[model samples]
Target chain A: MSVPNAQRQIDMLTKMLRIREFEERVKRTFTDHPGVIRGHTHLADGAEASIVGSLSHFKKGDAALATYRCHGYPIALGTDTKAMMAEILGRVDGLCKGLGGSMHLTDVKKGFLGTSGIVGAGIPHAAGAAWAAQIRKKREVVFCFFGDGASKQGAFAETLNIASLWKLPVIFVMENNGYNVVTTSAQEDANAAAGQPLSIKAKSFAMPGVTVDGTDPLAVAAAVGKAVRRARRGDGPTLVESKVYRLSAHGNIIAPPGVPLHYPEHEAITVFGKREEYEAALRGDPVPRFRGILVQNGTLTAAAADAITQKVVAEMEAAVKFAVASPYPKLESALDHVYA
Target chain B: MAQLPYIAAIDAGIHQEMRRDPSVLYFGQNLATTENHEFVAAYGHDRVRVTPISETAEIGMAIGAAMAGFRPVVELYMAEFMLVAMDQVLNEAPKFRYMSGGQVKVPLVLKAGFGFACGWAGQHTGSLTALFMGVPGLKVVVPSTAADAKGLMATSIRDDNPVVFMHHYLLTLEHGEVPDGEHLVPFGQAAIRRTGGDVTLVATGWMVNRALAAAEALAKEGIQAEVIDPRTVAPLDLDTILKSVAKTGRLVVVDQAPRHATVGGIIAADVVEHGFESLRAPIIQVNARDTTVPYSEPLEAYVIPDEARICAAVRKVCKTAR
Candidate 1:
């Protein structure tokens, strides 16, 4: 096991905690206010490490596109969380001036080209951005973050073909969260065992492919680091498959604790392993796991981790307050942006 | 004044725009095989990119490129292919500016060859101006003549919005005098093709040419039809059409699209609603038969609105059937 340095682990832990707390806070806000965050949200509860890990390798010129579960990405990309929270709340002071809502948080200056609600749509956007990078000689690389459901979209295949053909600097980060909405991959495909791993599908396009345990932030960062290096060196694109689980409903709209198994036991077991393993992966979430390792390695103590949590909590509290206080857009200004 | 074929004028116009601005580039399939070779020779391969035949991805790619500060003119080969990229067209590109709250401007022009008279059967023949008109942020332009084609090509490229530029297949074969250089036609302005007072003939795309011919035919019969060509739709020159309608007190709309929810239908509705007080007779709209265009030349001609159909609409609106 190649463990990253103590500092890297601490940083990942902090990011993971921020993501978890943000989603948790968003979930709580939505529950309490009901209509506070107007649009639907795809919370990033279990898939924190996959985004933060890969983005850790992202630089100033690098651009990233993610699916609708975008709150985590912009937050990790260093966007103004207050504005993002305001945007989700549909306040005029939001990042997108309250137009984007939860599904479309974007800050071009922050190198988050944006997020799309379309399942596999962001794939081509990344490929084109990478092409732009090459055309401008920007030496910029693009990272596309999508989910298991997106793999089924034709856009995923089309973008892969184009990216490899042009040798564009792009990384296809498949956050395999076990299920495509309610149907797990095993349920959707009768022979999940026989099928090649998702990353191996990159072989047809002659691009490098690798899989990592998404629960381990170190593993994701390492795999993505190599891909980013290869891309920066002009070695074309790579398909990096990070195995994770949603750990929540597709949108978490109506899901509650102790919800009945929507699918079969064999399906759930096949995806995350035995019940104990599946439960442990959720309970020993990467955020706490990394903190534990940091303590064991004498990097930091539990009190310090709690302190970090307190800081993040206070920050999110301020963001929500700012969003709640922000004004709604004027009704007459609705027709303003229809053109240029 | 330099006379050139409609295709050459548009090609030269694009080349001129590309030279004027380094940001303007082309993305389509087989630029080396088609009319885009001149583009490659002039601008090199980096700017004139011959993309693989993936309409959906290419549209998204073009939208992305536009979002990333490049003015890309993406060709859909035939307007029929716009169906494949409907998501990118109606949903993605059109909604980008509005949904982004004007933070992002999509200075992208999607060019496609549109018609039913080309003898290219059902799947290839499509007049989709109406389809685009339904979307709020999409601008649809169909320039009928070589001069207008060149001028409008430059204007659409320069515009900071998503404009659908359709080159009529038959119009491309027509020769006309094009302004030598830097000819620009602003959108939302209608060109008065012929002046008369008896009836107003409103047309678009190649139908403009047909309407002009119909107006000439009516002139010989003493009908005195005024012909107005709306160079662009969506910002449809409502003032020009309504002014002509008010002057003539009778309106006949000519369009190549089918009758159902087509551009002709929309124009007719607008005339009936806003130009109601200026009507001498019930407004007449001459559109193609609502059926899949057949491959045979005669059937193709039958499917598309032509001079005879336009003249007939004019006569009916004038109540002077002869």
Candidate 2:
């Protein structure tokens, strides 16, 4: 597999920073602009390296589907962040016209097909898109992203079995963040209890499985690039377990109307009382670590890195301003688009 | 026109679309297994293949494929099998278009047999037309006649939305004269099987035949009962039913599902609300008794609606009006 060039590496850093900055504004929206985002919104604060690196192999014809922690994928795919923010803010200018909001951010034109609020649900959808690509006689592949918790779902097993059997061109990316909504992986996952990597589940479906450090962009890119090649070659699917840390809680606290919503403490601290573990994750945060690597290797000057940071910050700030100023969709529009 | 059984006509409808549109796909469990399989031989392996008995994946993949610009028809033998993947059926397939704000269209069909009261017992024998009709993005089709079976299937495949094409198992081998080519039945149009001015009888799927038989029996008693079959329930033809009620001044609705779960109740509520003044007597509904469809033959016969019960309900409505 070809390594991303120095310029490409710097581009990856820029996308990673964009994701981090975009989501940081989303988290702050709960407090900075109270009640702008409604319902449960999961942030991809720590999975930037994983999200950006895996998508680095994406091409024009390729498609990707993800779970509810979905803001980062569309941002990395170059969807207008202003519309994404408008969607989160429930404005008419939103990506889905405020119908789907943060949990269901979809940009079909960019090949980020859709997102599923249900876990393990979007896996077969990617395989379905892969089937379409297969019929088109194109080497297009689909990237299926889900969390470690989704592996236990029946959809996961059933989809993997069929995907492998049909030799469909799709890559399964499981972001192993070690938590499934307040429960650690060991408490629920059999492989985790046995001290085996979650990637081992791919063996049951007769496909190659690999585990990589998700915080390292190059590591994730190299691993996912190999799988993309396998899929494009029509050899079948490969499961890549990119192990990362969920630096935030599962989502903002779910509250009834009139109660202010905001992000809670990391489950490692709130539920398990492991402050140091949470602190350690923050220290090894992927965004700065990748930036440090680029600076150390002379791919980016420290001055250039600061400039990129300032640019992303301003872009996201403008997105927030545009979103908060936008108007809500007309009440009658709720009846539209229900049939076709 | 050619004489065709309901099951064959459904296949003919699929063949019609597969011949016309290259993007139409047909796949499910226990189908197209070998080289000589009809669909495989006809469309090749790329568009037709057998899948494992994984309902969630089978339906889920169809949704993905539909969104990606292929029209897929999933052959689920029994309606209850959809319960195994209701999330994909009810939640995923129907919600994608609206959720995407018209960005994508899921043009697919879920073909399943329902109301199989021929000793299939509780699980397999369910009239689930009402369950899907209420869902916004889904179009529910219940074709009673062989001709309608072919026509409605064609319309469903061509429509740019998710459709649940429910064919009654009891009517699978029933034969009728189906048009030879490209016969398309529009959704939301009710078929008036018999026209009369004394009393109106409304039904769907297997119950349409039962209602027709009851209409014949009612004619001997000097009760001219008008019979209407709503080919599609989602876009229900309330206007025709209301117009029939206006002429007849009496009504009886027959459904094979339990009383509480019948589409008859929904129609009754609509007629009463919209056409209440036209009603000369309280409407009567001949629905199955509320219980798990029993395994015993006698119990099954007693629990579901039959021609005798439909006739009795029609007579009661006619008598009550006078």
Candidate 3:
């Protein structure tokens, strides 16, 4: 009942490529096109592997809850990219009818429970979703993705304890992008430097926890797949920490706090730098690395990968055009959702 | 129909609702110890859950469960603990429907015990009717009698919107008549506890009982005060309060929330704005002192607006009072 090796590999390549191309198109449309997007956007630049890798393991009807840097998951999960793009553009045709914007892209039908801008905020939500699934005796599991910055939060501590205690079908996926909005004290630098694996905390909660090389899509897939299977089997939750990088800024183009404006000027750098020092330490970009693995294993040809890339590029172009053509939400629609 | 204590009435409501709707979920810290134990025994542990002392997490999880098509009722031990889960209540639950373009319905009920009756001190006091009412999306309910508590609790569970159901800590032990089986007291409906002609007293939660006592005291002095209990705040029953004010020609608002942006002041403003010609005197607001609830019994007693204060306010507003 396993996915055939070549098919699985191809699926990974296609999802990762789709995310990279979609993000690139979004970045250009957001930064270059004037007045397209308003407010903050945290792109999952280098964490595409973790997002797609972790999500691929989840079966249909399973839920995904994540933090703000979540554009990649929905795109890779095959949510209507045009609706998401329109949402980012604040159009009525968008997924959330322009109210949720990029940070809140959701298609619950696809089991994307939605995203929250608050750090560690979505963790408990996943616990709740998993609890509902358990109560209904549904074989659905919830994958909760959080950041290292959020790991130290009280929500993290509390959610882990409750999730483990109730044995909810939840897998905690930590996308450690290594910066907590440029605040040294809040970031996980000290914990990571403590010479201990960050995922080890799951042991304290009496659940399995493992750290995987996040850039290696296969590694993330293996770790998350194991966790997912454990959850579906009613073995309680597992913490799978994928040590990835946020190749984009905390926001799409805006720098994290304390860094000078236009400091890295990533419009052409292709790599988002948190700080010059951290930039050098950043994990390798996952898209190209994943492509090389596929090609080397003879699972995919260079020509095949390029074709997928071209297809995604064309789709993104049309999506951008659709978003631009969509109409702005009516003013009265703002008050529509305040009550039932 | 049968007479039941506030706690038992709430227990009966939850028991019946969970039995009626399979999607209803109940969770909180130490729920196994509360009135929820009966439901757990009947429905099993999955639907009726006991969580760790994770206020913020429980609130977040409740919102999540509600989002995924479950009616989740989260019980915090006390109302003040709601501060820990403010973001989930104020930001997420309310905004979900609007953000999803009216596609999502957060049938979430947040239940908490309020008031200084149990002497649980500062962290356990304050019926925060005004705070939740101030938010646009939330429906705030405060029930006094055991009958009203059971009915309101049932209605809150069935509501397709987020509701903050705050029970007065003092009223939990008091016994009153509650209908057996299914009963729902609709929100935004005011209950007239006592009728009078000289002055109108608008009260909420346990304050309704206090206002009734105050009305009795005023009747002896021939003041004749009307007591109107606004069971819910957000979708407030302003029509009844205004009609009472017009009929009485004098208004005195009473509640446990602080003075600033309090429900008392909100009612006074609405009465003054719409029923200006009907008023014979300036409106009087009897509310708790604008300070954090202190731990001492006497200080706590002084912080809450008592029956004497309501009577005194009624006397001050009525010119023909003997």
TM-scores of all models? Answer: 0.94, 0.99, 0.93
Ranked candidates, highest lDDT first? 2, 3, 1
Candidate no. 1 TM-score: 0.94
Complex DockQ per candidate: 0.65, 0.83, 0.68
User: For model 3, how does the per-residue alpha-carbon lDDT over A22-69 read when each residue is reduced to its tens digit?
Assistant: 777777775457667776777787888888878878788888888877
Compose the digit string of candidate 2's lDDT tens values, residues B1-322: 9999999999999999999999999999999999999999999999998999999999999989998999999999999999999999899998888888789899999999999997988899999889998899999999999999999999999999999999999999999999998899999999999999998899999999999988888899898889999999988999999999999888899999999898999999999999999999999999999999998999999999999998888777777885
Point out the higher-scoring one by DockQ: 2 or 3.
2
**Which interface RMSD values do the candidates have, in the order shown?**
1.2, 0.7, 1.3
Give one digit per residue, the lDDT tens place, for model 1 in A306-325: 89989999988888888888
Which tens-of-lDDT digit does each residue in B216-236 have in candidate 3?
988999888889988888788
Model 3 chain B worst lDDT window (10 residues)? B32-41
Index of the highest-lDDT prediction: 2
CA lDDT, every prediction? 0.82, 0.94, 0.82
**What does candidate 2's lDDT look like per residue over A314-337, in tens digits?**
999999999999999999999878
What is the Cα root-mean-square deviation between model 1 and the actual structure? 3.6
